[model samples]
Target: MNILITGASRGLGLALADESLKRGHSVIAAVRSPEHGGKLAELRERYGANVETAMFDVTDETAIARFAAGYAARGKRLEAIINNAAILTERGSSIEELDMTEVARTFDVNVLGPMRVVKHLLPLMDGTGGVIVNISSEAGSLHGAYGGDYAYGTSKTALNMFTEQLKHAVKPRGIAVYAVHPGWMKTDMGGSEAPGDPRTSASGILDLIERRTAPSRRFSFVDYSGSAMDI
Candidate 1:
C-alpha cells in the first residue's frame, strides 16, 4: 500500500511511517519542516526509494493544493492517508481562563487541517479504493466527557463529525473513513507520564487499515486496539 501521513516529523506520525516501511509499504512522509527532517530523513536513507518526504502545513490550503497537483502529475496513487497533524492547546485552563486565539488555532489544525487534506487528496485515491484515518481522541467523545481542555476536546469532536460526513460522501467510491483514538502515548503531545507507545499504536492502526475493519456501512469510531469507541 502507498500511504501518505501528515505530521510525520515526530511522535505517532513518525512511528507510523517507520512501521509502514517495516511492513514493506511505500510511505509519503509529510512534514511541516523539511529541514528538520530528523528521523524521517534517516528513514529515507535507510529505506531508499520506499520512503519519500512531502512538505506542507495542514493549515495552509494553497500548499496542500500545490502538493496534491504535483502528486497527481506524478501519477501516484495513495492507498491510505493518515491525517495525523494536530495541536493541543490550553490543556488545563478553565473556561474563563481559556484563550480564544489558541482555541481557534487548535480547531484549524485538528479539525480543518484533515478536512483540507482530504479535499485536495481525495482525487489521488479515486480508483485505488482506500482508507482515510483521522487521528481523533477519546476526549472528543460526548459519552466520555471531561472538564478543562475545551480547545483540544471540542476540535476532535468536530473532526469526528467531519469524518462521518465524509464517510457518507465517499462510500460510493469504495473509500472508508474513520476517526481513531490512538491512545495516550508517551509522545510530546501525550506527555511523559502517558503509558501507551506510539509504535504499538501505529502498528495496530495499520493492522486495522489492512483489514478494513468497520462496524458496518457507516462511519466507525475506534481505538487503536480495533475496539469500538462510543460516539
Candidate 2:
C-alpha cells in the first residue's frame, strides 16, 4: 500500500512512517521542511525507494493542492492518508490566560490543515479503496474534557467533526475516514515524562488502520487499540 503521512519529521508521524516501512508499505513522508526532516531523511536513505519525502505544510492549501496535482500527474494513487500534523500551542493554559492568536494558529494547523489535505487528496486515492486517519486526542472528548489546553482540545474536537463529515461524504466512494487517538507518547510535544512510546503507539495505530471496516456508516472517535472514544 502507498501511504501519505504528514508531519513526518519527528514524533508520532516519524514513528508511523517507520512502522509502515517496516511492514513493506511505501511511504510518502510529508514534512514542512524537507531539509529539516531529521529522522525522515535517514529513513529515505535506509529504505531507498520505499520512502519518498515530499514538502507538505498542512496549513497551506496551495501547497497541498500542488502536491496532489504532482501525484496525480504521475498517476499515483494513495491507499491511506494519516493526517498527523498538529500543534498544541496552548498546553496547560487556562481560559483566562489563553492567547487567542496562538489558539487561532492551532486551529489552522490542527483542524483546517487536515480538512484541506483530505479535500485535495481524495481525488488521488486508489480506486480500490482508501483510509483517512485524523490523529485526535482524548483531551478533545467533551465527555472526558478536564480543562486546560483549550486551543489543542478545541482544535481536535473540530477535527473530529471534520472526520465525521468527511466519512459521510466519502463512504459511498469506498473511503473510510476516522479520528484516532494515538495516546500520550514521549515525544517533543508529548514531553519526556509521557509514558507511551511513539513506536508502540504507531504500531497500534497501524493495526487499527489495518483492521478498520466501518461498514455501518457510524463513525466514532477511537484509540490506537481500536477502542471507541468519546467525541
Candidate 3:
C-alpha cells in the first residue's frame, strides 16, 4: 500500500514511516524541512524506492496545493494518509493567562491544516478506498475536561469534530476516518518523562489499519492500543 504521512521528520511520524517501511509498504514521508530530514534521509537510503520524501508545511495552503498538483500529475494513488503534522502551544496556560494569538495559530495547524490536506489530496484517493488518521489528543475529550490546556486542547477538539464529519463525507467512497490519541510518548512534544514508546504506538495503529478492525460505527476515537476513547 502507498501511504502519505505528514510531519515525518521526527517523533511518532518518523516511527510510523519506519514501521510502514518494515511492513514493505511504500511511504511518502512529508516533512516541513528537508534540511532537518536526516532521519527520513536515512530511511530512504535504507528502504530505497519504497520511501519518497515530500517537503511542505501543513499550515501553507499554497504549498499543499502545489504538492497535490504534482502528486496528481504523477498519478499517485494513496492507500492511506496520516495527518500527523501539528503544534502544541500554550501548553499549560490557564484561561486568565491564555494568549489569543497562540490559540489561533494552534487551530490553524492542528485543525485547519489537516482539513486543507484532505481537501487537496482526497482526489488522490479517488477510486482507491482507504483510511485517514488524524492524530488527536486525549486533552481534546470533553469527557474529562480539565484546566491549563486552553490552546492545544481546543484545537484537538475541533480536529476530532473534523474527523467525525470527514468520516461521513467520505463514507460513499469506502474511506474510513479515525481520530487517534497516540499515548504519551517520549518525543519532543511528550517530553522525557513520557513512558509510551512511539514504535509500539505506531505498530498498534498500523495493525488496526491493516487489519481493518476499528469499530464499525459512525465515529471512532481510539487510543493507539485500539481501545475506544470517550468521545
In terms of lDDT, which candidate is strongest?
1
Name the regions of candidate 3 deviating beyond 4 angstroms: none
Q: Write the per-residue lDDT of candidate 2 for residues 180-224, one digit (tens) a residue.
A: 888999999999999999999899878766754333336558888
User: Residue 230 of candidate 2: its Cα lDDT?
Assistant: 71
Residue lDDT tens for model 1, 1-231: 999999998999999999999999999998887675677878988899999888899999999999999989998989999999999999999989999999999999999999999999999999988889999999999999999979999999999999989989998999988899999999999999999999999998898778745455344788987788988
After the best TM-score superposition of candidate 2, give how far the Cα of residue 170 lies from its true spot, in angstroms: 0.7
Worst lDDT 10-window in candidate 3: 211-220
Q: Give me the overall lDDT of model 3.
A: 0.89
Error in Å for residue 211 of model 2: 2.7
Task: For each candidate, give its TM-score against the true structure.
Answer: 0.97, 0.95, 0.97
TM-score of 3: 0.97
Task: Judging by lDDT, tell me the better candidate of 1 and 3.
Answer: 1
Q: Which candidate order results from sorting by lDDT in descending order?
A: 1, 3, 2
lDDT of 3 by residue, 131-228 (tens): 89999999999996888899998889999999989988998999988899999999999999999999999998787668546665555788887778
